[model samples]
Target: MKVFSICHVSIVMLSIIIISTNLMIPFYTVVAAETNCSNGDIVIAQSRVGTLPSGIPSFSVEITNACARGCSISNLHLKCGMFASAVLVNPKIFKRQDVDDCLVNGGSPLAAGSTISFKYANSFQYPLSLASATCG
Candidate 1:
């Protein structure tokens, strides 16, 4: 009888600990689910080659939020699809005009019809064959 009582109490304590842990995790999951944004929200996206003040070759990519509601994007970067080694040489991130405002307000959570630009500095020349220059 003593052994059975101890075992039952141990199981009950373990169950309580598990339930308490599970309850604390809902805060983050709920916040994330509320801000869910799909790929279809981006309607206007474009990229162009630009030059910095010193005439260093640079690339600029922009994305606009076209959905009726707001969404969040943590970070966007350039990705080389094929022959990544030979594609870009010494690519470095640079600041653009309006991007600083976005970071000041919040990293993510872009309002509807708003646009964001990301810049990168590189010596890549124009007319280079690229598999796909995309921002994600």
Candidate 2:
């Protein structure tokens, strides 16, 4: 009777472990998917190229999608305060929405490892910051 009871307890413990592990698999999967990318994965780099004909400083800006999991990012918004350029920057590439909000790529998706670059002339380089993005 004692040996039977011990075997039964061991079997019950093993079953409980297996069931719990199985239930946790989906939860872990969902969490991993959700964490694959974020706004931090978008990298912005700006460098002073040269002076424009108007004497304003020209800067080259490069925006890169650096998602580790090869995810795509879209609807990218940047924190650009009073963003303006003396030189023409295609509105389709970058445009201001509000006093401190600017949209990139006309709200289109930037594929993983892809980069979008543009030039702007301003008295000083505007500090562009990644404010928000959607990852897929």
Candidate 3:
């Protein structure tokens, strides 16, 4: 009876460890779900606007955490189908390409009120036609 109880406890603990690993993917330490940068969370989003092809404009965006607590931002992807738009216009624009880590000193974790920036360039022909952008 003692050996059976011990094995049962071990199995339960193993199951819990596996479950926690799966949960971490969604609730990991990058961007917590309860974290809202838009709703008065002492957060800020900014971008530097630039133009390409003399007619097309692009924005390099950044999201900063201004609060004391650490936050994770999961599912934080750029607008959908925006990559095709860049390919059609310039064939080289990427919305979420691996930017150089220089902004954060080669993967330095950002502290409270610290910022993370990403750069994306967009360009189109002289006559600009909407090519299905996910960003506003």
Candidate 4:
């Protein structure tokens, strides 16, 4: 038998490894794609309404992190409306916190299984029959 030098043996082994890795890359990518990546996403829903600290009508939206990783919140367009016997109420988000939050922290993130909420406020008195508000 002939003995190959260490340098030559090293180069041969490295070439084989590189070729194997290249061949396996596509298979690895396909396997990764088959996994359920979308299962780890976020969910938003209309939660409830309550009173603001300054005695105003306020409502909220619940955001839950259903993702396996952190989820970012940004450009959250929130609109308000009421349906009380043909009455129109243009509610506004008391966004001192929200507006400043976007500027300060772009795309606020929530960890997996965590929940955060956005609140909207208006000065609608009780028995006025304001029906529903929407946030997205």
Candidate 5:
């Protein structure tokens, strides 16, 4: 009797597992595709020079949503000269704590195919006109 009962229980459990696995396949596929946004990458990278007497220039760069679907843009870094600066090289420099803040406020969370712009002050102290400006 004990052996029969154990076997019966095992069969029931196996059926449940099989049913669940089958039901999950379709759901999993949809979820996976939804998570995969179209060509996740920032599209635009435009820079504008700030007008200043001290030869200080400011720049703004944007990242689109396509490149940031499931990405987080935090601790944004600003590289004006040939060498990258460690101090400004942070992902959390945005003024607000959202995706758009990375550009207007100082935060970075440009969503997939979404446009996120960032601004940096280019002064003699920072040296924006050095040669290159990179953001990481």
Candidate 6:
């Protein structure tokens, strides 16, 4: 009788452990599925590279998608007020939309861990801030 009781208690404990683990699996899966990218994940790095023949300082801008979960971001817009460059920027890579807005990557999705770079000639670097993005 004593051996039977011991075995019964061990079986009950094992069953509880298994049930709890199973119950927690869905919770973890839900959290993983909800992981998403945001505007903050779009990193923009600009630096002075050199000078142009027109006596203007040249700058290099690198935009990167730093999504931790391999998410993609699209339709990236930046707050670029009166942004202009003596050096021509590829319209497919970056372009001004309005007085205070600019589009990046031609409104296409930038994959996770990917970067787009462009050069511009201006007196000072534009204070570009992420305006918006669509994450997927």
Question: Would you list the clashing residue pairs of candidate 3?
Answer: 30-72, 30-73, 31-72, 31-73, 32-72
* TM of each candidate vs. truth: 0.34, 0.73, 0.32, 0.32, 0.35, 0.74
lDDT for residue 58 in candidate 6, whole number 0-100: 96
Kindly list the per-residue Cα lDDT of model 1 for residues 1-136, writing each as its tens digit.
0010011111111222356556432221121223334455554333557677776666654556564544434332222322122224332221221311112113344565677555555556222211111121
lDDT for 96 in candidate 4 is: 22
lDDT of 5 by residue, 17-116 (tens): 3565564322211211223322223344657556545555656655454434354333333333342221253344333233222222253344434555
Candidate 2's residue-wise lDDT over 21-115, tens digit each? Answer: 56432221122333256666889999999997878899999999987767778788899999999988998999999988899999898988999
| lDDT of the structure predicted as candidate 4 | 0.34
Compared with the true structure, model 1 gives a TM-score of: 0.34
In candidate 1, the residue pairs with backbone N, CA or C atoms under 3 Å apart (3 or more residues apart, or in different chains) clash, namely none
Alpha-carbon shift of residue 17 in model 4 (angstroms): 12
RMSD of each: 16.3, 14.5, 16.4, 17.5, 15.6, 15.2
Q: Give candidate 1 regions above 4 Å deviation.
A: 1-36, 43-46, 52-55, 69-107, 125-136
- Between prediction 2 and prediction 3, the one with superior TM-score is 2
Clashing pairs for model 4 are none
The whole-model lDDT of each prediction reads: 0.37, 0.79, 0.33, 0.34, 0.35, 0.78
Q: How far does residue 93 in candidate 4 sit from its true spot (Å)?
A: 13
Instruction: Count the clashes in each prediction.
Output: 0, 0, 5, 0, 30, 0
Q: Estimate, for each residue in 14-37, the C-alpha lDDT of model 4 and write its tens digit.
A: 222356556432221121211121
Candidate 1 weakest ten by summed lDDT: 1-10
